[model samples]
Target: MTTATPQKIRQLVDKLELEAALAIMATVEHPTAEIDYLHGFSLLQVKRDLPRALELLRRSEKAGFAPFWVKYMQAMCLSNLGRRQEALVALSSALGIDGQHVGALNLARLWSLELLREHLPAETTNILKTLERLIPIQTATAPAAKATGAAVRADTNSDAITTDDALMMALLGNPRLFAAPLVPSSGVSGAGIGGTISAGHAQPARHPGLVAVSERLMGRRLTVLDLACGKGGVVLDFLLRGHRAAGLEGNPTYQQRPEGHWLALADHLHLVDLGAMTTGFGEDRFDLVIAWDLLNKAPAATADRLLRLVSEQLLAPDGLLLAWAPPGADDDGDPDGWIRLVPPTGLCRRRPPVTPAELPVLPGLVPVFHSRPEAIPLVQHPHRPVRVVRGRNGLPALREEHRDDLPRVAVISVPKAGTYLVGHLLKTLGYIDSGAHAGMGGFDDYRDLSPAEAKQGGPHLARHIGLSELTRLLHGGQFLVGHIPCTFANRRDLDGFQKLLLLRDLRDAVVSHMRFMADAGRAAGQDWVDIPHGPDRLLRYLQSTGRIYMQMVAGVRPWLDVPDMLTVRFETLMGDQGERQAAATIRALSTHIGLQKPPAWNRIRHQVLGQPTKTWSGQRSRRDGLWTAEVENAFAALGGVELNVAMGYSA
Candidate 1:
């Protein structure tokens, strides 16, 4: 069989002709190791045959194909296979051998930032910074439309190319490779992977602020009305998320769909003068009313009337009023004045748009204020948005002026502890989401550590948060989250950050651990974690796993004593006494961090607590007392009771 060129296969892949690509793979009979590496890499996009793909990548490595490509793709496979810890370790190793490979770094930047959070390991950070420094592509109009037509290319070079099947295959896989402007000169950048994008491939995202806000509020469906929205920019943001969002633009130009501008959302855009809105215009009260710069533009009295009106009628009790503040003589003649009717409970600030949305009426980045239970004084909410599959770790910071007044906080807790509950309080208190969540940054990642690695524990907070990353996190308005056992290394690493340690009752912790493990195991297709039946097998499982359970019960001890750390018990923030204790905890936390207590605690609590976090599997059996007698007796027999007492929990 004639060894097919990579260009032909890539053309097929680009045109969505999978069978032809597979046929090219079928023709490889006595392939070299490099071809095998290429073959394995291409299979990564295939879903069911991943195990075989992994096997080939390993085989390629053993056959001396290339240490860098083999290990790098292996890390990608591991992550996709739901083995993130192994993937991180594998990536760290591969990066060591890469020696600042530019193409490799560019390919892996999004994944690295996604998995590691903003403060990455020192090695990954260096590579990504290099990628960030690269010049963006010149234009999107690459002349590579049919560039991968290797199959029908003149046969003069066939004899020479036939000798290096791998090289031909590599080029065959790059669709835009033949386009001079599209392909960079550094040939070996994505040698085996076959996928590469210059910085300018896609257009910049429009209305990132709106995108961010959509993602943050994506936890639930809500009706949002953005007043004075030109061309209905906010509609597209919520449109993708299935939220019903519309614009009330008084400008007839926008309402009628101006000649040059898009009227894509003309149906959703209502031609109503917001300045004259004294009574209800929309029949249903909105869950979120985005009065973008409406209040700021009106006179003080008119603004106050609009504020009282939005609060008293237009807004649902739990609705948010995102309004800009009027220029005030109220704050002793300060320009950035507060709203006179009701103070804002929660505030949001976002960086200005780099390329503002089309007909952007302060689209998402207008830096408007967010109000709960009333009209918002003009402030800013960084329209923070993230993709479901793509993580949002390296998002730009809130502008200095907006963030200076907010608080910086860190919470380190055990798995299944009250992570989201505290996160809820922090969000309500005006802390921006730093794109870190306990779902990924927890002991869950630690479970993959080999016994030797686990025993030789070092700084376990995201494995090692760099000093520079920690410094930026110190800026007010954002909070950090991680689940780690207290360690000397962690204590040293978290030295400058304000730390809060959260723990749950050991008995509840142990029970939640079991259920979580079983549920997670099933979700990951690890059927072996399920015990077959009855007491004897369960006893065998316990004998092997009992130590891990005890560790969850007790691992948070040293965390309690970190210098000036505010120790918050998970039970205190949830369960029967949750309302009373949570209020107290928030007050204590605000005082400890020296930030103003965010108002409307009940409303924030209702919105936050009512939503289920990503990690929430079901009604937590903790409140139901699932393993009370049996687990307690066994734990008592194992001396966990003493440890529980030390943590100030009941015996």
Candidate 2:
């Protein structure tokens, strides 16, 4: 029997004539490794048959054909099949064979960071280091050019080219990788990854500001556009409210009809080149335009051009444009005249200050909302500003009437006291949603401000938003959750707000803190604050930090005295009676916040408890006994007993 040439088989595969290619290969008397690999590749890419693809790839591996590529494909198939551990090993084998293989290295870094960060910290670090070295560095003078199709081909062997390089090339061309479904394992601490508030479902407890704004615009026929709408979560929420809404996303991949199950309103999403000024939308097409986190990422010129285009072509006359403006964005060429709805604060020290001429501007747009500097410090971004502007194309500007009667609530807690859990529960119950604000500076206490301090240009507190601004947020139905120390200065800010203070056993909190610090240290590549491993280190650190901890506890003392303030013990929420305790806490919170009707408690309960609990060390259970008598005596000597009693814990 004679065999068809490899070149002929390749041509058939290239044309996507998979059946013909397979038929041709079957006639080959003794098939080569290349034949097996090509058949497998076609099975995986063309037919999307994972099981058959894996089978063929394994056969190709046995035939000793392109071992690295075969292993890599096997790993991808295994991952898709949910065999993550096996996938990791296959990926590792591929990398071992060809250390410089970019695709395999990228996958290794992603998988290790996602699934094995705790189990394989060193390996994760090495993968990151390899990626850093392999990825070209870009400088101001010469930007990193997108790799062309030919360049991608040049980077890989011909057989390997069809598998790994094609995927990487697709990713390079699409640029909408940000819109990829977030892997469940990739979420950082205090971040909400899943369980989005679906359209028309009761509003989520998070992002109350968005809900309040949406409510104000309700009862009107308005066309809304979300610019650069990554994953279109916010746009879906708008659609649920029965509004005529559309999302313009730059990523081509995200522009496709989203999974119908996830979004029934996916038809409204459109893909456009956000980098281009002319988006082809008709003039005055949208009544409201939202551009979140877009301008800050673009070059100054591109940003200015995009804003002008948005104002002139996209936004209706008198339409509102809500944008995020980092500090220094308001300096000189303020073309859009974006008024800071909230005072700006530098969120990170590494951010360079924006000069007047460098500030993004859209000509003819004017700020309708002016910020009052005298209001309470808005600590969230401290450095970044939320700008609201009106496209003044000879139309009457719509004014936002502040609703003063909305219920306001605040959730305050010490660090590492399961505040995230409480916040998640509140979100599930359809209360104020502030998920965006969870990891921001405003959610932190003064101790957490040290990083912001290095970036501060003037008085530390000067960057904070004033009480008036905070009141405005509350009036807009914002839910404030933070670890803000209850200082006298912050008391006035807390006044009249329904408050909830979350407490945990100090010892447990200390243990949690130690684990958190260690994890964070490893992640940041920093030393663990001079503390050694074991109980002695924990005890000594607790002793040294007792005053700060006491201060945190003391901050809540005044709130405890307030009749309306709800106090929740963290242990109860974690105990065997956790569900009952959580339900009761929710009820107390609902009443305090003046909810007209209670949320679906059972549903919220399931959502809250169903979440996978994250633990740092299995030894955490054993460490409870690590507080020896001497440690207890030392802690008491440092005033832990008084603080413990004040917080309702038996010391």
Candidate 3:
């Protein structure tokens, strides 16, 4: 075999003669690390054997052929392979090692821009392009340079773009565009390349801020009201998550369009000018009120008003606002001084730039909190009628003032003994977590509404929010779930409130709790030593689980003793749901809530049963004995068997 130096082989490869370069490579008997690097580049060039190419790159690095270009090539190949996250890692690593490697920095900059551009709609993209061109290109007018914008890249004397990363914003003249996410959302696949940008599934992945919102509330489905929701994608995402979400689009074109999201969301989308808004739903209603698109372009004063409206009337006390500021808002931000956040992690931000900007607007995913976010009321115009589109698959759409006549109901589960079963069950009885009918998710916790009240009044005191006190807050169709115990002082606290108490086999609860800890252990670092497990780790888990859940289990009797408390068993709810005990439980709920009769189960049973959530266990207790003798002993030691007896489980 012929011996060819890397320089000789590289000459051919540089000429785009990859086949000849590969033929020369095959002739080498014992290749140097440089030759191996060249060989790997040849493979990547020909779009053949990407894995082997990566292996060769690794070998090159390990065999004293380490160079910054090695990582640059690897990042390129990884990005081409659709492993963008891995590509980012390699690029970041390269930057960490060689900060001035222009290739790696350029690639990262380009990738960030692509991610930002891909998420925005064509209209938005066009607007950005127009703004970008606002600042003229100060390149040469030479014939060759005039043919292309290469003069800027070729020019060494030009200092228009600095190293600090103000490149895009400098050329584009808007910090808002650079405010987009530099990376994809860490844990949200709510939308895709062709879905929602700000709110719906009709665009791309959301703006980084919205993606953060989705990731923050990843699995917990809460009521979402997307203001100025475009194409209803975000609303649709919340709806699919089983939250009763609605969207207010002042423009009717989203409905006028032939997009598929309109079908399921036709009943939920409303045409309105929020300047003069009014609905029967009371204050502190929604878990999230997204003003991403609405407040994004609004002036500072207008944005403040809108933020105030959301904080006061729309947002749940425990809820969050996924906010964004207009680029110009930086000019006169907080003009009216009404912007506030309970906590400000929810502020939107652009991802940090690997390249330092000349004039950095936002470098990392650091949020741009221009003014002190405090709370303000935003009033806007026009109430619109409900318009259900024609193509739904027989899904009912309601126009009543958001179920205001429905009773204020409270659901309390004794730890993991019960799942979110009764909450969904009560939905079958005209309860509204979001809309008029039973939805996929709900029983909005009343505590979330009165956080200050709950904190000041203590646990049981919130449920004591007597009937007259709750009349306006409940607004008829409210359903809340909490962990309030039936105490001596507050046993009568729930007198006017329709109460539900969920119970389970203490043995099964212990087993589930143990399984949860073990599962958690797999991902946890050494810091999760809170659970003390011994040589027989399984047995220790069982004992530990029983001890941990014992307090909640011990408090179950007071709920059972309260005759007004509608006690529902987890086993009965999950097992033969049609069995006598289950039927009796259902009857008790209906009678306790003052419903005329039980609902037709088969018709709405699927909706009531509810789907598995993030916390749902594949090994969730099905029958009995999900625990052991050790666990039973631990429960007995904690005096928790009373709940098992009251729930009618054989001890």
Candidate 4:
């Protein structure tokens, strides 16, 4: 009746010892859902025993183990057995559980297209159409010959020209489009169009002007179209508020399931060609057209055509177009209104500019509101504009400052070294309330600023009052956080700034970072999954061109010898043994920051040490000798041992 852990079974499976794995599973008197799933998966994939795998999978499902992966595996088994209908059904069920399951969606699109084409609801027909365009079926003679022929025909039909036609035409027109290209869309996932930057990257708190605009348009009887909608967060927001909203993405890889059944069935989401100068939507079709981050992708010729199309064809006579210029759009000095485009080859080309002033004279459209909103101060484009004809200009400034008597403190740490923990601790101690600004290491503001601008007071210091104004702004309570390397180049900016540098064991830090990158890459459908995981890969990463591990060590090395910098080890504030040390560190930090009254160390300890925030990739064992001998040898070879010892770790 003894049971083996899933990890042990997984290890056996990893080693290709399928028989041993099965034997271990057989020992479990009452095999749990997980055990059944692992056994079934191994049998199906490794042993290729389809019937037995199906039986075990069904049992696993019966035993309450019906996750999306289990369902997907079942569908795969059915497909391999030539049970098309059952496979399609299982895949559909998997999609129902999680619509964006990439593998399931890809399989369904490839094998179950006929079923989807015939059975998809009328409102969801566009989904099938989009899939058809992205993944064309191959013929014996040519893989995409049929699609290419259709595209040529579609392009010739100028009256009924679609986004697809425009894309085809562009590709056909420019023989060298892909050759020596600048700003090429390499390594970018097509899971969604214009997916260059994720919607999550847009911090609403940092850009309240956008939120305000959304709030103002809420409950309006407008038909909205979001061009190049990456992830469709804005469209979803509009839909949630009962507005008619649709998103057009240019990337073929982007796929998402709307939360509501109605939203999913509405066929509001479309996959379109952003590179195309014109979308087939009729003139005066949309009451509101939003092109949040679309312009940068288009070249000069294309941008001009797109603007003309937007002005003359897309917007209703009385409708509004909300557009924001990209980071460096205004710097292009072409008097004829041309802007520079950065292509994939790292070369720049002049393109027709889409400026704010042109909106006023664009046929029927007229500018209503235009301003460089305070929220977007970091934008490099000098003439960055937020223009709306029918919309109001009443959005409150996004930036807010609070002044208090408490001394300002900056908690700096190596990336992935429990920065969040220290920040949360400081927040809990009341050194700074919610009103206090907690930047990502203090360099959050400098991220968009140029190196020269950053050197000259940095973004926050320059944009706001200079260092002299820091006393007024950060009087009673001010805390900053940053991971910027402490080097001679940045010494001027760090001068007069009080800092606490946090460190962790180099070996653990590198492992944590690698796993994090892998997890994040997989979630974003990036190529990080192809990179092998383990000691060899870890060593390769340390020795890679970036030399990230060396940089990390060097970043903290300079600060170690500084008189005023308080150095704290991550291990000291982690786990049961470190609870007392955590309390002491907090006390020391409070004293350093000149807090009026020392915080309740017991309460702070309970909040931070007693219940630490779980690491994003799950907790790793803190036991010594976790690193393999090869990894240790590589670390030594890479000079990590010296850095580790200098950073207070025993060699």
- Model 2 TM-score, all chains together: 0.35
lDDT of 2: 0.49
Give the whole-model CA lDDT for all candidates, comma-separated: 0.48, 0.49, 0.47, 0.48
Candidate 4 has a TM-score of: 0.34
Candidate with more favorable, higher TM-score: 2 or 3: 2
Identify the runs in model 3 with alpha carbons over 4 angstroms from their true place. 1-404, 434-472, 516-538, 542-545, 577-581, 622-626
lDDT of 4 by residue, 285-356 (tens): 455676654444456666666556655566543345564453444454641222332222122222212234
Model 2 spans with C-alpha error above 4 angstroms: 1-406, 435-463, 487-489, 522-533, 576-579, 610-623
Tell me the deviation in Å of residue 353 in model 1: 41
Give residue 237's error in model 2 in angstroms: 46
Q: Ranking under lDDT, best-scoring first?
A: 2, 4, 1, 3
Residue 504 C-alpha lDDT in model 4: 86
RMSD of each: 23.8, 25.6, 25.4, 25.9
Residues 133-156 of candidate 1: C-alpha lDDT, one tens digit per residue: 321222223233221222111122
Sliding window of 10 residues with minimal summed lDDT for model 1: 175-184
- Cα distance off (Å), candidate 4, residue 631: 1.6
Which regions of candidate 1 fall more than 4 Å away from where they truly are?
A: 1-402, 437-474, 522-528, 532-542, 623-630, 633-639
